[model samples]
Target: MKRRDALKNIGAAIGYSAVIPTAFNLLQSCTSEKEKWTPLFFSVDEAIVIKNLVDLILPKTDKTPGALDVNVPQFIDLYAYNVYVEEKLEEYRLSIDSILKALPIPETGAIDLKYEDYDNLLKKYLKASKEEKQQYISDKNITYEALINLRNQSVWAYKTSKTIGKDVLAYDPIPAVQKGCISVEEATGGKAWSL
Candidate 1:
């Protein structure tokens, strides 16, 4: 056999070895287990607020799972605990605190509040126009920016979760050759690719 044929075979073997373990691991996600989850970073009240916030951002549907269902809050908490520096952690804490001040979280909890209230809040802050967000920055209120960051992070966490990545979106562990000839809608039924 020629050297070229041997090299191609070796590359294919390497690809297969790397993909198998990762694919298997992804198939076994935290969502499958019935473990009790607790917040890793947020305070009790803050955790309640964050939980509500994430739920509003991605509510469950008849067929699709929501952010909370896939553990987006847990992902956010763990990601922050692991990745953030002291100053960033402090900054985000302060940002969330500012938001908390605006909210009327009961002494007992916010369980009684309708879900739409949080959705409205998210729209007012994170979903606002660029100009409005900038105005918030100019006013020295970082809540808008903070909300944007949190929502972006939460959505990323949601998309990367095993359930969403595999079931909701397209999951191709070891990508083959690209087919630019087909439109995106036709390729994966308009579902975004998960990497």
Candidate 2:
């Protein structure tokens, strides 16, 4: 074989060798389970409840997708497991358990609150006075603090997600001009700017 022809064949072989593994990897990733969101910190049941709660907290609207769509529950699970200290982790777990227990769970082990009902329940809590909140904590064993923590986490996860920050919210990939005095409405049409 000619030297040039031999080198050409070798180059083709090297190119194919490099491309084959990457192709297989891409195909494998595509074929893998799409719904692989197991929680590290939460039990399967707890994870399910968290998922339901987060979805309820940030339901899908005409403007943007809900927490479930943004994988906020998964993010919460990871954040609780990885970010929290031992004391905080225990507190989070107990709070989650308390909140789950407060909800009406059916024989199927799922919370029975409809989306609207859950939203109303959240609103009720949000609107409650300090005395009412204390009464609720004493009576129902579900603290407002726990609910607030959950809300904060959900909001953090939702706002920080790439989908929400980059797509749903106002994201400028390349900011050529920086105006400090611009109103939010003037800047990004009332949507919060991406960090």
Candidate 3:
């Protein structure tokens, strides 16, 4: 081979050698983080996304437990796996994929993105005006619909949790007095009754 040709080949090899490892590392990190958790209904990536998204929906505050604190994602995973019919399950999977496609990869290049990464997208969809939400329903926007569904379910899971129900919300194991006589604001310090 000519001297110039040999130099060009060496440089090409060097370029690829540098790039390939970076790409591989990025892929491997994502896969490994995802594998750390197994979901009953969703895939590993889906579970991570659900976990982050639900926590954002009901983030931890000084007074109340967050969705993650109550294991909302796990409850959701099991609920879907056990309750959803085959066709509904298929539709749910497809909608989740559509949302996944719309999201940018996390800044960390891993499946377990920072809360902020998911937060921005969620606020855009969930905080829209009623008109815009109705428009999304009319347009049959899968991402918006899926986010709304997840948010509703997350809220349900959060409220129904044993800890939140018994500890955070107003719970009277035995009621000597009637709560209906007073307003919600008076009955439980403005907190709703535990379901």
The lDDT values for all models are: 0.71, 0.68, 0.71
Error of 2 at 6 (Å): 51
Ranked candidates, highest lDDT first: 3, 1, 2
Candidate 3 residue-wise lDDT, 44-87, digit = tens: 67887888888778999998878777677877776566445567
**What total of clashing residue pairs does each candidate reach?**
0, 0, 0
Candidate 3 backbone clash number: 0
**Predicted structure 1: lDDT:** 0.71
TM-score of 1: 0.75
Provide TM-scores for the models: 0.75, 0.70, 0.74
Clashing pairs in 2: none
Per-residue CA lDDT of model 1 for 1-195, tens digit only, reads 754344344435675344333333332433434246566777767777788898887889998998888877766765555445577679988888877776766666665656776777888887779898789888877777667777887787787677887899987888887888898888898999975
Q: Best-fitting candidate, measured by TM-score?
A: 1
TM-score ranking, high to low: 1, 3, 2
**Highest lDDT among the candidates is held by which one?**
3
Which of the two candidates, 1 or 2, achieves a greater lDDT against the reference? Answer: 1
Which scores higher on TM-score, 1 or 2? Answer: 1
